[model samples]
Target: MVEIISIYNYVMRRILLIQGLIGLSLYDEIGQGYLNEIDLECYITDIIPTLAQVSNHLHPSFERFYVCTVVKKVFFFLDHLHTRRIRIKDIVSSGLLSQLLELRDSAKSRDLVVNETGNWFSMPAVLEVYENYLDLDRDHDGMLSKKELSQYGSGSLSPIFLDRAFEVCRTYNGEMDYKTFLDFYFAMEYRKTLSAMHYIFRILDINQQGYLTAQTLRYFFDGIEEGIKAVKTVK
Candidate 1:
């Protein structure tokens, strides 16, 4: 089942590479336009100088932002390859992998120099949370319940939303694993673009009934209202 889902995702991503993600309709034209207009090699050359300039000047947050921007932009180039049905893992295995690996290490070293902060990187933070999950998995079921995941509301998310979200968004056995947790996190927290809101719906749609009941929406909005009030009242 897991392998089937993984392959489905892989194929969908590849199809999306060529067809554009229907969920993110705006990006469809943008991606197409990018393919038509951008000379990727030239863009890479332009960014080389910009990256060198970014390193010479730094504030911690700004440095992180700049580095992340560069990383995101570079990763965007992967879409071109994706459009060609090339898997990034294969690319990672190629001669380019060492360079890409070093590139990230250099970025990480620079980021560390800027901020000696703990667990600033995403993967490490996720791993850290994974350890926390293991500790909190009281039943040893390898699944986290609402009681266990309540702590997810510590910052950015509302406890109410988390509670209701579990009821709505559960993909399997009315429970959540690390992967599903990440999906919920990204969908609600980052909420990066308009289309990402589908994730929210997945969380809000109770009963797999294909539409949200007013009661469900009201349940979610109650969380939003509570979240707003809490934020406003925070000391």
Candidate 2:
């Protein structure tokens, strides 16, 4: 159900969210700058249209870095919103932050934490990852197939090695959900020290793995070398 709210309330809610959620204060650099010659309220009013236009509008720089702290603050708030299932689409049309406050108000009424959706997701980090997966899932079938997963490899990672990684994931369970997707993805990308390395080892085990064969090691190094090149290029 769409909640029709007053415009004044909407403006005030935006102000509050700016202060409380995004953690921005008119007394700070952002309030003093970027919003040149205008008061904080007026600045927000001007950007209300832009805010309404973009859902993942957090941390916007327009290529400038001075106000990046403000950007991070905004993303932190957006992540908080996402965790509560209050997607950006739900409230951007209300002129601004009123939707966020509206969700806050609903939670207050139900004696819950900004959600009546019942039972907060157990894994918030995974939920954030799932949101990324949704972006990756072009078909939107609620499952990621090999083609969808391959988008991460832009001719840098060895396609054959990726297939083997997929095999290692499939060995555990064929059905792909957020959980196994994390298992697969973190193993390939996150690079944290854990069982994900075991998955890598399993991939290297070609023909009973040939004692970490030269070809298998090269496949892994190819991805690493490409990643280093990309980072250096960025630098």
Backbone clashes under 3 angstroms, per model: 0, 2
lDDT of 1 by residue, 125-188 (tens): 3334445557766788978777677655455566766766776654467778754554454444
Model 2 per-residue lDDT tens digits across residues 1-235: 2345577766776676655434323323534222221232343433433332221232343212212222222223333222322233322332334433333333344343222322211122223445667876788976776666766545355556667767755433443555446555555663454445555666778666437867767867787687668768989
Model 1 is weakest, by summed lDDT over 10 consecutive residues, at 19-28
When superposed on Cα atoms, how far off is each prediction in RMSD? 16.1, 18.2
Model 2 quality (TM-score) = 0.38
**What's each prediction's TM-score?**
0.39, 0.38
- Give the clashing residue pairs of candidate 1, or none: none
- Model 2: which residue pairs collide? 205-209, 206-209
What value does the lDDT take at residue 6 in candidate 2?
75
Q: What is the lDDT of candidate 2?
A: 0.45
TM for candidate 1 is 0.39
**In lDDT terms, how accurate is model 1?**
0.48
Which segments of candidate 1 are over 4 A away from where they belong?
1-141, 155-164, 167-174, 207-216, 222-235
